[model samples]
Target: MNLKAWQSLVFQENQQLNCMIEDILINSSNMFIGDQPLRARKIYHDKQCEIGEARLMEDYFVDNSTYDDAIYRRRYQMRRSLFRCIVDVVIANNDYFQQRPDAIGSQSLSPLQKCTGVMRVLAYGTSIDAIDEYLRMSGYTTRDALMNLVDGVILCFGQAPQVSYIVNGRENNRAYYLTYYIYPSWTTFFKLITFPTKKIYKLFAQCQESCRKDVERAFGVLQDRFAFIRHPCPVWDKDNIGRIMIACIILHNMIVKNELDAYLHYYNPTEFLNNMPTNRQPESYTEDDGQPSTFSTEFELEI
Candidate 1:
């Protein structure tokens, strides 16, 4: 509405209005460019942005050998092998993110450090500030690291298109096959199973139920491994949510690939079955009372 302010907004054919506005803003006596009073300061010298070089995040967590295996695993939620694999892939794929020119020419966060920070946040379900102190990065830097890391991971490992299969059974029904189905109770179990004799069928039903619990336990393990998924997503972006989920699953797959052999070695099914006793000892609730443990089958039913 002011006449003098209105006179300055002359639109050019090239439409450089924003640049003109920026020039007008900083040339108002405060910003000094040597003897030239109107010239604005360079971007590198701008007081607003913290784009200069800082401490490396990997220096404390990854390079330092002070942390034990347990501490490292607990913090990162993966073995060193798995983390290294992730870091390698991210470095290979996220080529656009390069160190910028700064005071020391910006050694910014290394690819490993940025990816590690993202993985730690996803694993711990902590606020960005939680990692700021140890990581030596501001909250915004950590946030940017997470966004970029997830983008690269999702792009690198998103599910590929496979040959589609649908067993219609000639009824033209759209249905997907579930990995497993569950029977909620004994009544529902009897309804679904055609085996008439309860005495013979009970053991089979119990075994199926145990397998269902095992499936549920896998999901529980995933939630425990990456607590970010268990918590409500704070970001409103749908694409970002998808990226985060895909990245987490990709990381989980890497962990499985790296650690599955160790798991199989430790819990060899054949060896466990060979050593299994016919009669298992009853668990105790208290040492002296002789009461059944809450972990016992009968006590679990009562609860």
Candidate 2:
């Protein structure tokens, strides 16, 4: 290219780069820069006053309105009492959430609203944007609320006897709890160990599969009932996501408890077993008699 043309092109590119740099610096400065300490302190005081004024609005939002009714349960997938219990526990640890505290801003979100927002994120599996209108919360605020609320709840409910089983693993817990008992049988051990084969292995496998199927069916119902946990979580933070997942499980347990009293009487295993025909004793055999030679009598597995 001609020297003159090259110089012109270079000049234009330099101007464009300068403009871009100016734009970036301006945007970055706006994001990070703020009022000085004195001004900020005054602003903080003003916010505290606003938050204090907003306190009076809380009386209008009684916990009994939707809380005392079935509609609240349907929407949040948790009973009012259980949710209130969460809010109460969370408030005790983090007084910033309470309706009235020894601190500043009157406009801050209440514990109830925070709890509701967190549940909405889990129950609907939606973005923070979804709750803005109903709860009148900004996406930024709601997102922060959700993350903190999950942490707070995990602090409160993470170690409860029921939720303690989360570490024992979900599927294993389901098997232990719902299955009530899993007998020590060859089929149960076959899949869990490295061992020899037997003619009865297929029968044992079938029995194991049947037991697993029962577990699967129960899990399927749980997942289908609570769609929030069934699908891939949209949350970015692994810790927050784990907490939310655990919170949903705790809520699920509470819901199950509410419904259990209605149908628990129908679950009469003793009656059902009594109706089944008794098994016949095997013909007398020695301790070393014609047991399956392929079976490893020494094999004993525990999970």
Candidate 3:
């Protein structure tokens, strides 16, 4: 199909993907702290900022913006406060730590904060102390609190599922059945005790071996691309380190899924089938005192 048709079909079949991409765009923009358009809108033009600042003053905290002499100075402080309030709102809405209230010190950690910290440690292989420092620079208060938040994130990831392929065993199963039942002769039957049950058994072994190799390749990529994971994270806190590992696993899964999906979509099944050799017929044989012997003189000569 053409690209347009493919996209149309995807949109028709999966609205969720479209919605998710939109959400990513919006959330990513909100997460940006630089002097970008989205950040500016959050500070000066957004109605939420006005209400948040009003509530800030009403709650008895000194409103720093009220005393600033210049509009720029006032806007800067207001933007900082607005950004902080937005972070708090994001955390409250997600409720990522509904069960772990202790992590955020009475409030929940924002999703952006949790995700960013997790990704940084996972992607960079940085130490928990380093993650703490990075987050602290962004306004997180304590290393202990960050570590607790990281632990909660890890718990969330542990609950996620591992990916695997489903083999329905159509032609593959038929071939196995033929080899094991219809084609087996007296000599082959005696050899069955030591040989594989069927070609499907070998396929299963090959699949598992391929999976192991894929995992090793993924780890190699991570180590090469992200230098920090090449060595142990220098952080002393185990919880923080665990969260980083979970985040890396999640990223790895995402990459694998994308690659696998592409392979499945574009790969030619005919070519794959052609690459596999035709199954050989079981050799005819005779058995004497439970010993197997083939009639072919070439087999006897080889022995």
Candidate 4:
């Protein structure tokens, strides 16, 4: 339907709302990921509800017209209403969302949800309170309840391996021998080694670093764009506060992914390229005193 028609329909359906949601969807579609534009349109259309459903919703609203009730009903409908069809579409494309738990009730979440929540918390540095608020705002009841849900999500997500060096000599292995090293104790000696497997481990390290940088850049952008976070959020309910924070994190990730994709598409490279070089290369030595340097006294170390 044309924008004008949609606007009129929205007005006729709910006069209290001066503007149509279609405009929000249409205008914001460009800011979204692939196929999101169409999905937004679908959400706008499907969420409108049939006459009978609208009448039922109106009756519910009339019966319970408090602000809290309105908020609850709005959120509930957003999750379960026909308007949520677009959300389903978006979540279907995102394995993270698809794998996340539905509700933080008595039931435990699957392994994937646990891992994803843990990773998200770690990556975002989001406070437990913030997570709780997010869940509550999204329809969860209690902070402890939400924490249990997050625990399950984190368990499902699992812990990523911690990369460290070990001494194992092989052609592909790079080993360093420390004859003596001190760490607040008598001299200790050990051999440290690392192997570049050219496999998932290597890729994971690269992706981990990339994800960290992306999260940092995203927060920077968010802080720049929305100055509110720079100041304290006065909202007292910890659960509500957490929900807002999580929502911001989700939005930030969405924006970052969109920008990254656009950048890749603009470059049209056959392979994905890191924003900065990942390979370690030796720096060329130069004499600062205008004298020829014959010996190199410094070496690069990987932590």
Candidate 1 lDDT by residue in tens digits, 1-303: 788666656544236967777887787755555546556665642322222123433333445555656676778888866676667776777763554555665456556556666777889888876765555556777788888888877777766445444545544333232233364444223222345378667766666667667858877877888988888875578988878877887777777777777676544475445554334454556657676555432222222
Alpha-carbon runs more than 4 Å astray in model 4: 1-142, 164-263, 270-303
Q: Candidates 1 and 4: which is better by lDDT? A: 1
How should the candidates be ordered by TM-score, best one leading? 1, 2, 3, 4
lDDT ranking, best first: 1, 2, 3, 4
Which runs of model 2 end up more than 4 angstroms from their true locations? 1-68, 99-105, 160-196, 199-204, 265-303
Each model's lDDT: 0.64, 0.62, 0.47, 0.41
Cα lDDT of model 4 by residue, 196-287, tens digit: 37687676556555665786786787655333354565446787556545544544444454346446644435322433333334355558
Q: Give the per-residue lDDT of model 3 (tens digit) for 70-155.
A: 44222222223333443454455445423244432443333444444444454455554464433331323234444544455344
lDDT of 2 by residue, 1-303 (tens): 999999999999999999999888787755445632435343322234334234423422365342344766777776667777777888889765766544542456566666676677777777777866556556776787777776786677666664224544544333132131343554224352223288576655556668778868876866765666777876777887677777666666667877776566655555444553233223444356666434222333445
For each candidate in turn, the TM-score is 0.56, 0.53, 0.33, 0.23
Q: Per-residue error at 130 for model 3, in Å? A: 7.1
- Model 3: runs farther than 4 Å from truth? 1-114, 126-149, 160-215, 222-227, 238-243, 258-266, 276-303
Report how far residue 192 has shifted in candidate 1, in Å. Answer: 12
Model 2 root mean square deviation, Cα atoms: 15.7
Looking at candidate 2, what is the lDDT of residue 132?
Answer: 61
| Best model per TM-score | 1
